[model samples]
Target: MIRMQRLIPTGDPARPVEFTEDAQPVPAPDEALIRVEAFAPNRGETFLLERPEPGLMPGKDVAGLVVQAAADGSGPRVGTRVVGHPPRGGWAEYAAVPTHSLAELPDSLSAVDAAALPLAGITALRLLRTAGSVTGRRMLVTGASGGVGHYVTELAAAAGAEVTVVTATPSRAERLRALGAATAVHAVAGARGPFDVVLESTGGADLPVALSKLAAGGTLIWFGQASRTPATLDFFDLLSGPEGAVIRHFHYAGPNAGPNAGPNAGPTYGRDLATLVRLVHNGRLHPEIGRTADWSKTAETLVDLRERRIRGKAVLTTGVVS
Candidate 1:
């Protein structure tokens, strides 16, 4: 039987995440089994473990070699190095990844970088797209130094948007500017803007300010609620004027975005993965990975993430688990 590492959580991550051995999976007619070289946890994974699905493994971005192929042509060939987004099983030593979710990695990029691409990259791309054309527009990004937020800043800046970054901490302010912000403002200052677009990843008192900055026809897309504070908006803000705003919430794992999405959003997963991986491989874009931890230290990594001590991505290398 194939061996793997899995997480089983009964309470919050303050408790130890149990590591267990399990039988590795065999591919059905269309699924491929991935030998996970590296996997990274995202916020969603933490939410998953604390909820009803206590047995869920907390990683979606996976990079590794394809050790087994499907009977059909749907799966990758044996020994092909690739970065993939597996639904729930990626934190394990081996995962049965659906063929449609796997994207081939270019030889030019390292597996570590490849492992970092899919989740944050796809979310960023999707975030900007939903905000519509950003060219020459004024945009603001909250948590501009974060995993998805940094990429959002870079992507929007690269698109020629005049980006204003709102950050809560001073440490990330410089890096936010370096990521291509026309202005970097602390969350407390509430920078001036009739923003064409505003995206909030950090919430709390800053939410209304980010929302108010949006210009008419401008859109605000917020996903994460890391600030652990309540946010309320007044319709009077988005009601009128050329500088009025639009607000929308974004979450890839929601009704229209994730595994349970409808026919209209059918199979959009690998599409973004393909585009993001290609950009990384071509040296056009790169994601920031804060640190790499082994599977044994996965809980510690989660703690660091929760504490916001690390920026960008934190990944775990399984290192030949069998």
Candidate 2:
């Protein structure tokens, strides 16, 4: 049996998880069996546990060593180190993941860092790509201290954009500045911009404020609703005459077309993952891992993430070979 951290919903909203052991997974023809070493906890997973299923694994990002290659001769070979976004979920000692979702890891990256990369990294990368050329452009990234926000800030900066960040945590300003943000502010009202592009993640009153800052012909990409609050906007102000800016919403699972494909489709996942890993290896990008604990602390880790006690990314490690 594999000792996996299954999400056992307690039916109590306050405390909702219990870990249990389970049988080891076997890979299918198009799947790879990975001995998972580390995984990251995301706030999105909290909503998934609300219904309380019995034996559901609650992680999407995983990093580990491949113990069994796919039966159909796809993906990485056995004994390769990899990071993946498993479809059925991945908080376990072993996961049977689709070959298409896997990316080989470089020797320089740690399991914790790789585990933190898949969802947040890819989201940030793809959203910025959608904005076209960012070199010398003015960009505003809302929620710039959060998981995806930070990556967007760093990557945009690396692309030569003059990045301005809006974050609730002012204490993270200096760190964000070091990552290439020209300025970091606590509120959107404090930001200075006629920004060429706005990556808006905080959806609430902030959404309208973000919309107001976009320069003529600028594009605003809305990818998340962290506040779980609604925003009211006047149609006239949003699309005013010929100077009205553009607003595009982004989700990882959208349909594939041209270079803009869904996260799992075509060569998007593997290609993007490879580029991200290379950037990290070359010191061009950094994955901020805020907290890491043994997998035994999975429940507490989730609580910390939900309460906003942890900054950046929170990771859980198995700490032993399977």
Candidate 3:
């Protein structure tokens, strides 16, 4: 039995995480055993922890070294540094991940930086792709200072879109501009647009405002509910114009939504991850890692994340990289 430390849910909202010892996972024919160097928590995982069966592991993005290669020789080789999204969880010392969900990390990226990719990065990429070609299009990204929002701004700008960012934190405006956004504002209201594309994550009242900003025949991709509140909108009025906007709700792991996607889907996660890694390597994109802490501080980190205190992404290290 390979002894390893893993974070499990405690089923209590106030204190959601607890560490426990578990046997190291064994890799399958198409899976690789990773020695996790670092990992990041996602808001979606918080919702999962509220379930009755909260004892399961609770992380999705991880960066680590391959301890064991796939039995079928289909994934990364042993000793390769890789980042992956494990379906069950990843906040552990060792995890068994499907090869197709693993992306080899670039030499320049630290484990902490790579850990911040995967789910957030892939979600951002898919959001852009779902919005169709952004070349010369006028685009707006709500929650622009966030993990997915930052990436969407950068990627869209790189694709020749005139990117504007909407952020609750006023101080993040300059940083958002540095990330390739043509403009950054605290509120979506009063922003100049009839935007060609709107990638919205702030769900509550902002949803209707975002819908209103869309240009006729434009597209709006709603990908998150950061506000955790219900949004009210008059559908008839919102969709009344002759060139009504196209509204799409995107879930990265939704059925048949990605490459080779299935009930246990994630192959496309690896491909998108690889693309993001290349962009970072080539200096075309920079993933923001907001903070880093020891794995022992997992509870505090999660609280900060849940409380919306941290900016960009928060990463937890297993004391492997200094």
Q: Which 10 successive residues of model 2 have the least lDDT summed?
A: 255-264
Off by over 4 Å in 2: 1-5, 53-56, 240-242, 256-268
Clash pairs detected, candidate 1: 215-243, 215-244, 216-243, 216-244
Give me the overall lDDT of model 2: 0.82
- The most accurate candidate by TM-score is 3
Better of 2 and 3 by lDDT: 3
Candidate 3 structure quality by residue, lDDT tens digits, 1-322: 7688888988777777889888888777989999999999987677666663735777789999998999998879999999998886699998899988899986798898899998888888777766778999999888777789888888888889999898877668888888898988888895788899888888899988988888888888888888888878897878574277888888877754575556776444678878888888888878887889998988877877777788889999998752
Per-model TM-score, in order, reads 0.89, 0.92, 0.94
Listed per model in order, the count of residue pairs whose N, CA or C atoms clash below 3 Å is 4, 0, 0
The lDDT per prediction is 0.75, 0.82, 0.84
Better of 1 and 3 by TM-score: 3
Ordering by TM-score: 3, 2, 1
**Residue pairs with backbone atoms closer than 3 Å in model 2 (clashes):** none
lDDT rank, highest first?
A: 3, 2, 1
Segments in model 1 whose C-alpha atoms lie over 4 Å from true places: 10-12, 51-54, 235-244, 253-263
- Candidate 3 has an lDDT of 0.84
lDDT of 2 by residue, 267-314 (tens): 346667777788898999899888999988887777778767777899
Tell me the spans in candidate 3 whose CA falls farther than 4 Å from its real position.
50-52, 255-267
